[model samples]
Target chain A: MKVTESDDVISFAGGLPNPISFPIEALKASANHAITENGSRLFQYSSTQGYAPLREYIAAKYQRVHGLDIHADDVFITTGSQQALELLGKVLIDKGDGIVIEEPGYLGAIQAFTLSEPTFYGVTLENDGLNLEELEHALQQPNVKFVYTVPNFQNPTGLTYSKEKRQQICEIMAKYDDVALIEDDPYGELRFQGEPLPYIGAGKLENSILLGSFSKTVTPGMRLGFIITKNKELMQHIETAKQATDLHTNIFSQYVIYDYLANNDYMEHVQKIIALYKNQADAMLNAMEEFFPAHVDYTRPEGGMFIWATMNNGASAVDVFHKAMDQNVAFVPGDPFYTSKTGVNTMRLNYTNATPEVIREGIKRLGSIL
Target chain B: MKVTESDDVISFAGGLPNPISFPIEALKASANHAITENGSRLFQYSSTQGYAPLREYIAAKYQRVHGLDIHADDVFITTGSQQALELLGKVLIDKGDGIVIEEPGYLGAIQAFTLSEPTFYGVTLENDGLNLEELEHALQQPNVKFVYTVPNFQNPTGLTYSKEKRQQICEIMAKYDDVALIEDDPYGELRFQGEPLPYIGAGKLENSILLGSFSKTVTPGMRLGFIITKNKELMQHIETAKQATDLHTNIFSQYVIYDYLANNDYMEHVQKIIALYKNQADAMLNAMEEFFPAHVDYTRPEGGMFIWATMNNGASAVDVFHKAMDQNVAFVPGDPFYTSKTGVNTMRLNYTNATPEVIREGIKRLGSIL
Candidate 1:
């Protein structure tokens, strides 16, 4: 058995954001401010409802940026968007309930919902987003509780739903009264191309719950995220579920982020990160175009860290992953991302952490191995 | 219909440690050092396995302080002791599986386990600890997956098990090979009286999992805790569960606590808190004895925040609570702590937050209402 190399290898297996993107100097100032201004409250066990000021900021952001009229009461701060998914799974998913997911969606979502032993229904992904027809068919099945979608630049696929598809999906969701929709948009702010589309939850859709994160746009290590919903019944259930989880997200992290947002230009900071990742993505895609086999196809992502690639001629992604690792480049085999047992010849390559030069070099090495 | 006040009352309701006890200066320094020295790593997504240095420190403390031969591999850092309980509930309990809990235990544990829909068997509590006869009877029930206990200074009751009871409980657990034990000891280090006893997990009890927390001793708002178990299978399952729940505990908080532990005198700091709480507890107890009716009875705890008080003649604690709140004093009624539907004529008071003078005044006001 071959032992895996340490950090010496250039790898795309990690879903980490660029370290340079973190506002460390600003955070230090915020930390000092928090200590000086509200040290006692920062250390205290805060309400399970989360910090009021932070919630207000988040609520205002949704309204001003996305044009969604969310009140502070509708927002629940979580340890991460991951925790929001878990809480939803706990509250909404009865044992053996069916949950729809994109064919190659996030493994974290799958893991979060799997604890409830929910039957997963996979909707095939097109260039735009989830296949609407497949999703409608899945919702027709008995016990289908909710549809989990990353409408923005998705985790592994890095695919965003087109405006037409987003509207159609929302329309289809409106027709189904029983099934709720979980719109997990962690990477929404990372878009590097075209105008931002309205969120699936932007319209007066009571059944849709939106999950947004500071992880991608701000700092992943802070573990701050939130859920927005208009359905009072569902929000109450999720809030209870959140209480049972970690009581609430860390008060200090929430306060620091609140302070940071209050003082800095969040959009500008996110744009800086988007610029960094865009350069890396361009380098990787250009290298892939130059060196990859003619039969291979990959998504031209608009934004986010990952680029989904599919090899031709029935080549296993796991096999490709092993070969790529040997070449000092690593990517997560896309099989785990799919709910179905049948493996696809696909993998996810993350470009955020790598420099432009490293991305080019790593992709070239991987191409040679392929 | 009368409108109830928002649940945001000055809660003696939560089992929170004194906010004053948090070493804000040390934490600020640690946070500064973590960001300044290791900003990139601190801000980056960390291993799901947890921060290595923090795990090593916790493991070392277990060995040095308790003479327990536990390795770092045996420890898993969690978002909080709350998440540890949540993970255990997810991995261990199946629907309809029986779990043994104290008659009046931590509400957080109850809420965490409720998601699994396990049939809870409540064991009666004794002055020292859990009633052994009741515990044995509960353990005899078929499909009892585990017995959850807080052996050292329990949450609501502030009771610690005697050395003999600990040995007997371990022997019984050994006798029943199928049954597992979850010993949550968040308040073990806060002992103000008697010498510290070995944890039940220390006696080569492979069937037990011990949970330790930095919350009560250091800072609850940091939300740092760990689970130690000898069972590798259970630990692995929990790690998977944790990955789904929140990916991992916040990396920055983990690093901050690790750095603080490395550079600061944690023991001395905790001792100061213990001394402060002991004085507060003494003041509260003295006030209660002087002011309360002769028929009212309460426990005099050696450590931890709570004092479980029972009213005579089935008097409603909720009524007393309302009256006390009207007099500007508040406490959590004990009924919600029980797994059973039957309400107990009792309430729990926390002495940790209030100063000696405040505690005495609060108790006097509460006594006047009763």
Candidate 2:
């Protein structure tokens, strides 16, 4: 009873995939298969590092997808990528320690790291990538823990960094020996138009910690994700942190996901997601271009669930949010995404959940209200 | 790859339910039913408070089982009771904070809170319950965050507090306005022969935080657990901490558990488990009575998975543990369970994981070694 609680509300605030994209048939089959074949083990306690085959598969996928050499030992399966952030916060952040994040960042990351009592420095984001100058300055801050970024089709904003910026950011992070770099890429496989850019992890930055999730391409219900890094010391700390947190992620989930991945062409399945989200994203963008107020500008995202819209002349998104709720149309207000007193006039509109017609209707209502 | 990693290793180290006790058939049916009927919602992201019906059910169960008046709003579903400990640590413990624990306490709880850098004060536990004077002294310590205890057939020791002791402990904790009380009852429902003692929360301790788990009754694979509290402020902090941790537990697991609970007589199933474990525990106790050396004292537990065994005259359990492992019989060493330098001659043996024949052979071997 959270984001999907109301049926009357045309909600575009969710950061997950449409339920129709869920591989229900395959999952059902996998459930039966796992229960029949590995019920005793699947339904029992598992290691903190996760199911061996699944971890190996994830490691292999990284090699294939990002051209990054990673071992199974370097990966630990989490309940979700959010848990990874929380574990990283536990392992890395100290009270009053500085943590670098993107301005208008993922709110979940903000919530996760804040629990550890870290001081945050949010680097401004250009259309193409992060502001390198601000990132450098933030990295140079005393006791800076890590630079957190969603480098591929970032949440809320749905912006992917250029290849040049990706490499440059990696270099900038590498120059700072103390700070680790978290390259969160939940939407990496959702790209529609451009060639897939190299992950910052591919730059071979030893401190580059890459996080990936199946929430967008697969089902969020499973809540499966992974944290991969070459740093064994950091990984060991994270593993201990994870064990301290949940013992381990649900073993049944790891088994089900593994069964599904092994029995199906996961890449082909992700391709279908890319196609569907590409259409939905295009529809939302097209409607926004046609119906949005002249002063309101939004990103033209190639992939991911959301479009970041900023209303010029200081029009508050929270005000619009309240008004839109009355109209039975909802979008997430952007203030929570900002660590500072910024993004007051910005909002995140998710395009992945609603159809083209619904997107158009919602945009029309908002335009008239504005 | 934890306790059950090797088939050759007859490990009594695990604190989970036997896999054979898992309702695999019912779970498979529930899985299929959930996928077919509620896949869209089940697989989608849900609330941090948990699935509404499940929370209501948990609150109802507490009323039925422990005679506690609780609301659905007072319950937050955790990944396992382990995550509850982790969240508690994050909310309550800070670097150098004082926390009271039982001597030879739950190792998992120690691991969870140690991440928060708390200075632990372990009070010695007697047969019936904790030594009240020591507990009172520990509670009076400056900066004490909370007192953590598993009062119902506790892990490793398998010691359940008497109802009067539970009440007194609650009153003692209530007097300490600076600290809270965590009553972890993962094995409360497993009592086959003992009288149903009132929970510490039933004493109306204002600061009491109760944790319960479904892992033992249903299956550990799902990793479903809950944190119940009447204190809304503390509950809010735990919810925020949980949201930062894993967003929420696996949704499908919640749906399946809910479905199973609603459709079946969950109590009857648990009763079946009670019978099975009671037999196993009795067999192990009988074997120990017949085969154990005179100086090797052990608790005659009426319930729970473990029996507290202490070898007299300073016999090192660490040495016994290594020898036991060499003989292909494994148990958790007692050192990790203690917060202080004590319990040197102690070890814990689990009865839930072995059959009567196996228990007999294992005890015979251990007796010969002693």
Candidate 3:
């Protein structure tokens, strides 16, 4: 019996944050306050650069956290970090321009860059970070415009770059003056344990572009994300692209989000989400340990939404996925995550969207299938 | 002293809707209700196609209004109609691909299409519509992907197509089997006096793509706009482009907007807006008639945001703008509106943002400069 998109299925397919962690009450209050305080301004078309107060707040927060000399003008808000990817492609990529990505990368970035008709070079993503030798080789290629990475708690793999590796990678890329390092850190704040890793290239490299989003920490539905860079000329080009794309990000959402940040303890709210995800990750990891066959391997993620499982016994993930669906369980096959489409025996399990018990049940079913 | 960015300037330079017309209280109520009813679902990442209910409502409304058969799947919501333009460009345009646009077009559309690096063919927009012969000639050119038009009260020009011209243009366009017709009607609902015109190509042509927006009637800040089309293959390609551009439009805004429409009398609210714009439109035209020099010819717009003024005396609008700025008055010099940048003697004056008295005063100051 094949179960497809049933309510009874314990699914780990969605790359969504736990909705239970969303600050609903605070957001509701913020929405009302934003409307009341700003009035018509909240409903009016704002600048292409984004809402002023929100941009300033983002700049200040980054400065405080990273101890970087970041300015408000450097923080450019987007519809989501997804849009930042699209806009970056518009700015940087011409037909057949070289773009470097991790072997198994965030598919969203892959999809966004594909529209620009770039030749993608996939550098292998090791346990700590990118394989530096491979990255340098890719960077050495002609017209290599940028290297995209989700360094901290990366999507699908749930991997973070080690501090030493981060430093080493930045040094390796420092030779490539024209190349940009895009450090997309959507899951940086959701660290369940360990010290937060510094971005590899941001402060050191002139062409470093950092992306952050409120999707994981605050809410995804509002679609508020931003790009931070000190490169004025690059930012100006991006601003022009952004204007052409959608005029600007939604102004009302910007005001409401800024208001929510102003009124609430944002870190406190993020802490609650971290706690929830930590529990779910533990449950899934423990379930895999208890039930999976000896040949199967999976990452024990410290933070972030996904735990990547690799079938070591020459079993295809797509086949396993079909069998798992028969047992009322689901997960994303890992093929889509690969630019080269060679992750045939791997699957990505999202731990954030499900409760601990439900995650355990889903993993048990998948383990039985395997 | 020149007025550069002072609050005292009585400006007719903004292409913004009257904030007085924004259903603020209803929106606030709907926002609250949408949150309370939907809970976490409203805050989660939604479908790439957009919220299903809102799409359905839009399709139903178009079907009712236009007497056309439109399914819910035909309507795809965007961040703004601006995004629709961008997405259309992304799907249709390759480097040096032929694209047809108005001679004096909406700057936003021009900006959006420019990113795709298309070879723009600007057909002359006559008093009623595009010159049929010019349009036919342009469409005959190789690889002409689409002809874009704002048929009802066009941006920068404030001119609507005559009924006969609408049909004639469609008939001429019918000769080109591969070319699409994009009928952008952001201001169709804002008709203060004249009868609402039928879309030239929509429902009549297989490749007709209609763009609409809530920005003019509802609120621009929410950034809600949509593309309606009967062409499944074209829409699917656009959906792919849209997914790459931004994962989705703000889902919270979509739910809030849908809820607002569901709970409130949307047409009644629109009627109030129409009435308000009518007053503002009349005020600006009356002021223009009373104050403008004989050599300055301007469109007496029946509806929509702008009044296009042309200087028959060969004085640059930019020069006039500079002089008007010294008098603490402003309007957009129309050079940016043209693809070839030849609207030197034309200016676009927006009446919607300013009050009637301010409009009168600004026009009087502009008249003195003339």
Candidate 4:
């Protein structure tokens, strides 16, 4: 049952980025530089909005890469993207307020939103994106506060929205003035295959909100993430909420990370991580294609950490999980991903935390069980 | 109104710990040591509870200092003590639930609790501690969830509860099974003049919770704080809430702080901070004594960051705030400290962020206005 504890276990259960992907020596130097340069001000209480230089860097990155009109004021730092979910819950959601989420959604989002006790309207996810009809239906609900989407390399499923679907979503959401669009893009920068797609609502939609995280690409242990939006009213409320939650995210981490980004080539560092994860994703996909039974269907992810698999032969994933544990292999059963009680026949496999060889071995074991 | 931004302004408004008190060099060494020793694990995702050694150190400190029966399992790390308040609100509070607070409460607590939309019952603070009668009245409410107190050197007030009052509070709270007792003790270790008093409910009551922070003694920029409780049920709920909030506190900061504590003389460092704060407090108090009008009453604090001043002649603090600004001085108006709309004649002066000469100048200017 606790195969994760065993030294020989090949676990794909974690959502962790590989530690090898972290630029440790560079970060250590950055930490030292930030401490030496900033002096005691780095250790003192700072503005609730966050460190100005870090926010400026984030704004500059988005402006340069996306050609979006994002400014430093548009970005607000958070403890993590997980906290962005919680703060949004605090700021926007009321009890029984309608929240539109992808069916078999990100569990962390679900967990954060659940604290507000919102009425979840989960739309079905298609191969390319969310089901358009279901998205429209969920949006049409009178109390719907926001439509939450992970447009690129989505968690658990590791699926990206098609360009056509992204445009349609923007067009449809533009009609609803009361509703906000939350496009979470933690894995957007990790795209290793195919052309990068533009965000669905970031610039096009008036009420669009974007969530970004350094957890996957840089470091998760620092727990630095941010919310970017042009909506001043909503941002103001979140600032207040952020102040109450933790005053601000860790300023020491903020300074250290800002120094790291400033001194080193950030994109070059990210490219190394992209290459590493690309190899892992390829190994897992190839292993599944070779060894998995025909009745067991799985996603071939382009980027990000996870692969979603469904047993079309009606094999219960819970039973398979037990058998896999017996063989010293582990993965997450996908039931917890859904807002509703579904995904019983599905499971989520993570490729980023393990090596290519370990991922292949783990998938081979799972394929035998299937 | 913007005197705070001016260089010549003597600001007594900030609740920041003095930068001079921070052990920057020692902490820099600790940061380097932690990153070098732990490798990339320090940058990866960690336990929701916290870094184990840090929690263990915290637990052992309480066991050794207070003779409280605490273990590593009893301590849960948070982003900051501010987040502890937020987590408590999430776990223990419901809309319309009864919350007992001080009359001039910690504004951060007020902000955090306000998110849950709880019905706050403010028990008046006497010279020694909370008014026993008012506390009893609040706890007797049917929906009372918790009683929040800053028992040692409270924020804005800088008052410590007497040993007798502590005993009485424990006795009174022991009757309320449903109400949890939250004794936030951030400044407990910073006692410079008085004999340290025992905690009211940490060892005496079943549902007692103690909130501690490194923000005051070590560094606020790192945003590390924790909750220590023997109540497993409440702790489990807080753990879930913490995981949903930010995954965990910054592990890099946690590891570095733990490393610092392990390698350095922590209590010796704390003593230095205590001594620095004591001198600042004495300087402000002495200035106030010499300059303030006879009609104005203010507390002579033995320890902690602030001194509460009340206009006995019924002068409006807001009006005084404007005049003080005209003279390029700043102090916090006390209206926000109350849960209710009161405290118009009171103001909170902070001593830790300014020099003695500056504090004297500020008090002189404020006194002329008074």
Best candidate (score: TM-score): 4
List interface RMSDs for the candidates, in order: 1.0, 1.0, 0.6, 0.6
In order of the candidates, what TM-score does chain B achieve?
Answer: 0.95, 0.96, 0.98, 0.98
Worst 10 residues of 2 chain A by lDDT: A1-10
Question: For residue A49, what is the lDDT in candidate 1?
Answer: 71
DockQ each: 0.80, 0.83, 0.91, 0.93
Candidate models: Cα lDDT each: 0.84, 0.85, 0.90, 0.90
Off by over 4 Å in 2: A1-6, B1-7
lDDT at position B15, candidate 3: 87
- Give the per-residue lDDT digits (tens) of candidate 3, residues B81-191: 999999999899988999999989999999999998999999989999999888988988888999999998899999999999999989988888689999999988888
lDDT of 1 by residue, B171-232 (tens): 88888777888999988888899888877645467777899888888888878889998788
True contacts kept of each: 0.82, 0.91, 0.94, 0.95
Instruction: List clash counts for every candidate, in order.
Output: 0, 0, 0, 0
Expressed as tens digits, the lDDT of each residue in A42-104 for candidate 1 is 877777878999989989988888788889998988898898999899888888999999888
Q: What lDDT does candidate 3 reach at residue B354?
A: 78
**Per-residue lDDT of B225-324 in model 2, one digit per residue for the tens?**
9999888899899888888888988998999989888888888998898999999888888888898888888887767789989898677988887788
TM-score of each: 0.96, 0.96, 0.98, 0.99
Q: Residue A269 in candidate 4 has what lDDT?
A: 90
Ranking by lDDT: 4, 3, 2, 1
Best by lDDT: 4
Model 4 misplacement above 4 A: A1-3, B1-3
